[model samples]
Target: MTSYAFTFPGQGSQAVGMGKDLAAAYPEARAVFQEVDEALGQRLSAIMFEGPEDILRLTENAQPALMAVSLAIVRVLEARGLRVSGHAAYVAGHSLGEYSALAAAGAFTIADTARLLKTRGQAMQKAVPVGHGAMAALLGLDLAVASEVADAASQGEVCAVANDNAPGQVVVSGTVAAVERAVELAKAKGAKRALLLPVSAPFHCALMQPAADAMAQALAEIEMRAPLLPLVANVLAAPVSDPAEIRRLLVEQVTGVVRWTESVRWLTGPGGVTNLAELGTGKVLTGLAKRIDPQAIATAVSTPADIDAFVAQLGL
Candidate 1:
């Protein structure tokens, strides 16, 4: 028996027409899109399938859209007899993808997950004014060196490490000037490339505290159940199953470092997860998994063909 973990992609994985083919081929996939639209009381599916890139790229739309596609893929997989809880040892996701992971694991209803993400995206967007904050990726620098560079760049500002994505890849988030300073400092400190990201806001920093508070209130109102499988939370970089603990971590994750590199290590390390199935639109996480641990097998399932191939591999 193959021991695998299911992973989901986050924001940057979205693209126009992502799930259209899957929806065209599977009623289960179509229903996931329909439920998200109804929950949000708008045609998110249309926006996803027919994109006015500007509107669809809005944080509010992109967050739930990504989740919907992920859940759609999960529904199709389940319909094909590849239930995650039965087949995978653990489930994890990047940033907003964590919500997708929870929905796939039966911790929350599809409708609830959609609503939460909509609120989360809007709140996060509203947290910091545009042009006031920023995020940048420092390539060829380890997390410790990245942290040192961020600290040096802070200069009494809010520069902080946002993501430890993979080996020698760390992202920093802060005030625009501080992030720019960090970029130069990282380059000076021997970073191969330090470039500002095209993101709208500086996420996962003190600047996002307001968004974290909003998520606290929003998450408090939702009813959460223990996940069917353990979740490797981004903030903790460890497995967590308690509903209340998960709720708290979800809030903390707003302003906390997304320990993607550490989380992947924890999954493939002592967790003994040898295979990673990325159940989302893009192959972002699949690529990251290979870079994180070359020994682990990674695959992505998105379109109908990908789903069929994955199910065949499982002999289902």
Candidate 2:
């Protein structure tokens, strides 16, 4: 009774020439880029294919660009006679990648997903002024210890755990000084590594409440359908299939901790998911899956060769 789940990557995974090879080989993949460009009313494909890294790394551009690359891989897979509904029992994503997962599950059109992610990235960036907020990664510390470090560092400021990524990897987000304090405290508390991330804004923290409010309004106007497979929500770390509930959680996720560690455990645990397929540009999620559960089968399917190998292995 082995099962599989499709996973999508978030912002930091994007690169300048992410889906170019895939699009060159598959018309379906090229169409995904075309649709995303049309939806955004701009030539995002050009930026993605040939970029000044700085521009592509912009929050607003990176979010939808990553989603488009993910969906392009999904489309290529479908064109290759491998269907998600037949292979995956669940879908999950990190941060903005949630929108990509929803779209892959047929909950939203690619066009709408592109627009929504653009709006989301902009809102998140505007939520806090530059240099006023920050994020940091704490390695060799679990959620509880990380929370303690964040709490001890807060000191009337807003330092909170943003992502529980793996066994001993956590990210904290908050005001710049508070986050920097957390980094110092994490090292003092025996964390192997604690470093501030170079990010445009503090995400998945109370500082993002304004972005959450903005998402509420944007999501309310979009038509959502129940996903083909249940989603492992970032906030809940559990299966959620209800469309209305999905919408609510999307808003909550803006300022909530991404319980990726718990979500991966649930998938490899009682969910009985044996295989985790990362359908995007980078192998970041694949690498994280191995860190989370070395026994779990993790695969990356970005290029045509990867897809071919996967299809052959699955006998699809």
lDDT of each: 0.93, 0.94
Candidate 1: lDDT over CA atoms? 0.93
TM-score of predicted structure 2: 0.99
The clash count for each model shown is: 0, 0
* Local accuracy of candidate 1 as per-residue lDDT tens digits, 1-316: 4798999999888888878998889999899999999999999999999998878889999999999999999988888788789999999999999999999999999999999999999999999999999999999999999999999999999999999999998999999999999999999999999999988889999999999999999999999999999999999999999999999999999999999999999999989998899999899889888899998899998878888899998889
Off by over 4 Å in 1: none
TM-score of each: 0.99, 0.99
For candidate 1, give the lDDT of residue 301.
86
Span of 10 residues, lowest total lDDT, candidate 1: 75-84
Q: C-alpha displacement of 34 in model 1, angstroms? A: 0.4
- In the order shown, the candidates' Cα RMSDs to the true structure are 0.7, 0.7
**Pairs clashing within candidate 1:** none
Q: What are the per-residue Cα lDDT tens digits for candidate 2 across 1-316?
A: 7799999998799888888898898899899999999999999999999997899999999999999999998988887787788889999999898999999999999999999999999999999999999999999998899999999999999999999988899999999999999999999999999999989999999999999999999999999999999999999999999999999999999999999999999999988999999999899899999999999999998888998898887787
| Model 2 ranges off by over 4 Å | none
